[model samples]
Target chain A: MNDKKWIIAGIVVFLAIFAFPFWYNMGKAAPAPEVKLTEKAKAAKQCVMPTEYMRAEHMQLLDVWRHNVVRNAEREFVNTEGKTFNMSLSNTCMDCHANKADFCDKCHDYASVDPYCWDCHLDRSKENE
Target chain B: MNKHYLYALLAVIVLFFVAYVGAEVFGLRIIFGVLIPYLAVIVFIAGFIYKVMGWARSAVPFRIPTTCGQQKSLPWIQPNKIDCPNSTGAVVIRMILEVCCFRSLFRNTKMSLEEGDKLTYRWEIWLWVFALAFHYSFLVVILRHFRLFTEPVPFFIQLLEKVDGFFRIEVLYDTIQTGLPGVFLSGLVLLAAVTFLLLRRILLPQMRYISLAADYFPLFLIFGIAFTGILMRYFTKIDVTAAKSLAMGLVTFHPTAPKGIGGIFYAHLFFVSILLAYFPFSKLMHFAGVFLSPTRNLTTNTREKRHENPWNYPVPVHTYDEYEDEFREKMVEAGLPVDKPFEKPPETLSDEKADSSA
Candidate 1:
């Protein structure tokens, strides 16, 4: 009954700020990154893990890889698919993906994720391109 | 009240500290890093909306604004518009000042007894000054933490950092930075203000008598958070990269517990989580309640307008025709005028019988 136009405006502004995350994520989701395999990677037979398992648990694999390679100075990564590769993200994963911006960044940007891999590991693939 | 405050403070401190210890020392990373943070955020949002909606639904039944100056009345009178608002524009301006600058709090008057019988009141400035300092510092600290959540951070946030961190001043021959670059001074000032507030409550008998656990608990909790934060920043030196990664992970729903992040980091985080969860249900809701407060929000225009209660129901009434009918004979005896003269029915045997009975 009272003149609450400004009050209403205040509420709306507050809600816009308060519900920022919801609005930001309204039509957005943690995207399923499209893994475009490089020519060399596609030619190779076995990956470290299958696509589904890697999608769900790649971070854990990377963490384990970090512990093994960094702390213990081990160099080999044995895959469940009966194959072995060097334990490294930049050297192994980036070697295959080749394009960090198109391949690795698609999902990270979608989810607002900032990984620490780039803090130490330089994206050498992009430079080569 | 004292017992409640003490117990609540102790409980929050012990509980949060233990959770932190458990997470760090025992490697219960999932709870601290992911689950608890998510729960707290959800609770804070839901509870905040529920409380605000509850206040919005309440009906204000009277014009009960706390006016401290002249109201709108005679044409010749000069109304203090902000202090005693009678229009929407005035109310809005007043509210902005109240919310942004805590205008009402700034007008606080401290009362004390001087020389036994005499009483004195003075404009209190220290409470307002410290309160302002505490809030602005806390705000800066919060804004500064946004860098941890976002990648490449925003430009405005960077600017804010510059402003917050700029503590350089010239002293005679040389300009020197007195505090840690960005947030140390604000953090320390907030802590000091909170300490002063707590001391005031404890030392003053009148304030102490009125104080409750509700008052002390938040102060102690905030102090604990600040203390631990300062420790993490200065002494222990937790891996900020790891902490940021964990924060980003939580935000993105891909939580990662970076190794060697330390328990102190988790402890600071635990305290924050507790604060978020507790904010809506507690007096901290005044953050929203200030806008809805009837005494402060309503206009002072009761004289010019007739406020009809919408809920008022109709009641039966007696007509003048009915009253006249009942009192016609009495009106004739008292020589009072009536709409119609009473008929004298032959003043006969009926009148004699009535007189005998009387």
Candidate 2:
């Protein structure tokens, strides 16, 4: 088994080495179809500050303080969904995802794919119940 | 075997299976390739934020900075200001030097015995070279990749590219190839360094013993990410723009895993995903953990002012005088000198004779 592992590893290393030149040469001989640069790449060039108007329009220190202080700091309880239950991020995630019908169970009930984090994070979920 | 070694072995096996066997064995290419990368990024950001917040909230009342150099003292004595920075400005410079250049690590040495049984501190320059290579290459690759992740490639990104690929190796294909500031070369060097680091840990029994699976797994996983990335760049090319769009979407929270991206891309994605999900739970958490460490963040003002650990409990301490009194008879019998003379010949035991004679 170990020998087999070594053999496979060696092959991978060999292939990795040769793969580059092979692809480059192939591209040279027969050009592959061009892949468009992603919008993000385009954005990299374009996503500059829209305007400096906001920064330029300065408010008096007292006015700014009054505006900030008058309004109560809004507590963000739930996300876009108007779920009223208050909980921290990790706990909120756990609360829904821990049970069969609640979260883990719902996902598992649907045979949806779970991830490696579930192995550790779910341990707490199980213990919570 | 320790649990970590087991995890390392497991990681290797899983990597092998995914890279070679899994596709053939289970026909689950997308799972191994695409989903993993998607998952990894999500988890990485979430986990990083979670860990950082956790550190930020953790109570640290006392300031304790570990100093290795001389402190500020009398005018005649010079302080090793760089080593033990006294001011915040000095600390910031020190931190910049540390984080950017790994200045302290650059001075690393390996001690070994020579033929004459003499201890020699040989400079392990390669370790520093590789470390610097890995980090700097990582930085470059990330900067190069900015083109794919943002809407318009930032001017800085273009500038960085110009600086990086200043030497263009134009091929006959007429596509101006950027070579001088090439990320690919740096990435390869980084991979080589990471590989060397892993081997150093594994090959040396001392390191191997101390290492947990957490150590091995990240190395294996990162190695896989690099390997698969190399594959995508050189072995087979993917749609660079499409990949970037997907990345941008991810950043903007509009998740979309594009189709026709190929199985190898998915494989690369999967490896990255594994790294992300595993990061917080593994030694890689050091990225955030370093910021929270009292030894690094704290200012060394305790010497000037009393700063006690909140968790400390008051314990009765026995003084040296008490110790001497307790063991006086035994100490005298052993010919040890005593402060209180046993002779008793002089009545007022004292003041006049002691002062006058002294």
Candidate 3:
């Protein structure tokens, strides 16, 4: 009961404090203004294309990368010893993994995950395989 | 009393007096808007980085998951698996629910005892509503500001703007007409929600008693930012092209502080800078802290292998035989395990010594 009373009282006080400007503005006239959009901005807006359909070439490329690398290696292993030891997994993996575009673009173009990582890393799909 | 309420009241009074008296006494818009905003930005960036790094450096050595639901238990019991996640995979899902859905907050219940001695648990859903409004509105407001930075606004942003302004009602009365800007509506909604949040903390006795200056300061600063922004949008109009150009200049690394932006915009910018600078140092840093917490990250895979604390030091161990030797007689009398063959060793201590010498 006491808590409820206090909450009600606090809310009432808060409303009263903030309500002043609201009521004052109620009687006042509304203001109207117009803003102009720049021509350069309008031109830029026109060039943007709506992305909808998935490309078949992307899916085929992705299929090649996914099957050729990740599934080729049957076993995964870890080494605690600090040595320049080579693993079969890395041998199969690093060829495609060395560059993001070799793997990421092929799948992302098909998967519908919009290319944000490409903004930072180099796209190697364009490079000679 | 809520310190934020007092601070906000003081800010409104002081800012109003400054805007009215200062402008009347000595007219200056550049000092109010550009210089102060610039200073605030510097402070905010420096402060934000410092605070986040400070949190990152702090070491949390133990695992303490704040669990409310059933933990991983007997296989037949069908564990409330999502609540008490025992693996990294589960933790990710839990984190998603926590961050995106605010799962715990959604389940928040208020308790009350009725007149007939019956206990009641009612959903305190308003807190969730306000919290959602505050976060999403703030997000929309930030996204909307992207329009000023990028030359071409993204399609998603354009879609958001259209969706936001679905109800296009234009009320006209004698040369005065009012239209809605969706971003402005969201900003106002955020302000209302934040105000409510601050009020809840102040009004509740338990919350008020525990509340510190750190808790109050951000709320006060945010309120100031909201109020100043509201003033800029509704009361005083600013030059949008100049503002956009200034933002673009900042992004392009050749910041030329445009002249003609309103003082209220500066006040808003100043408050935002203060918030940014204060973010890393304040309790509001839970935003970054959430990512680093080991309780949320570590898997409960103790059954598989021992997790040796990298910081633990090695210690020597003593055998139980040494302990038994000290109390051998007591052990024999008590029929406990003894080191020596007690039944066969009948000779007294002196006789045994003499026989060995012979």
> In order, what lDDT does every prediction score?
0.73, 0.56, 0.55
In model 1, what are the clashing residue pairs, if there are any?
B5-B213
Between candidates 1 and 2, the one scoring higher on lDDT is 1
CA shift at B11, candidate 2, in angstroms? 1.8
Per candidate, native contacts kept equal 0.01, 0.00, 0.00
List, in order, the clash count of every candidate structure: 1, 25, 2
Tell me the interface RMSD of model 3, in angstroms: 23.0
Kindly report, for each predicted structure in the order presented, the TM-score of its chain A compared with the true chain A.
0.74, 0.24, 0.21
The top-ranked prediction according to DockQ is 1
CA displacement after TM-score superposition, residue A69 of candidate 1 (Å)? 36
TM for candidate 1 is 0.69
RMSD of each: 11.0, 24.6, 24.8
- The residue ranges of model 3 lying beyond 4 angstroms of the native Cα positions read A1-129, B1-4, B7-60, B116-121, B174-177, B180-184, B302-305, B316-348, B351-358
For model 2, what is the alpha-carbon lDDT of residue B325? Answer: 80
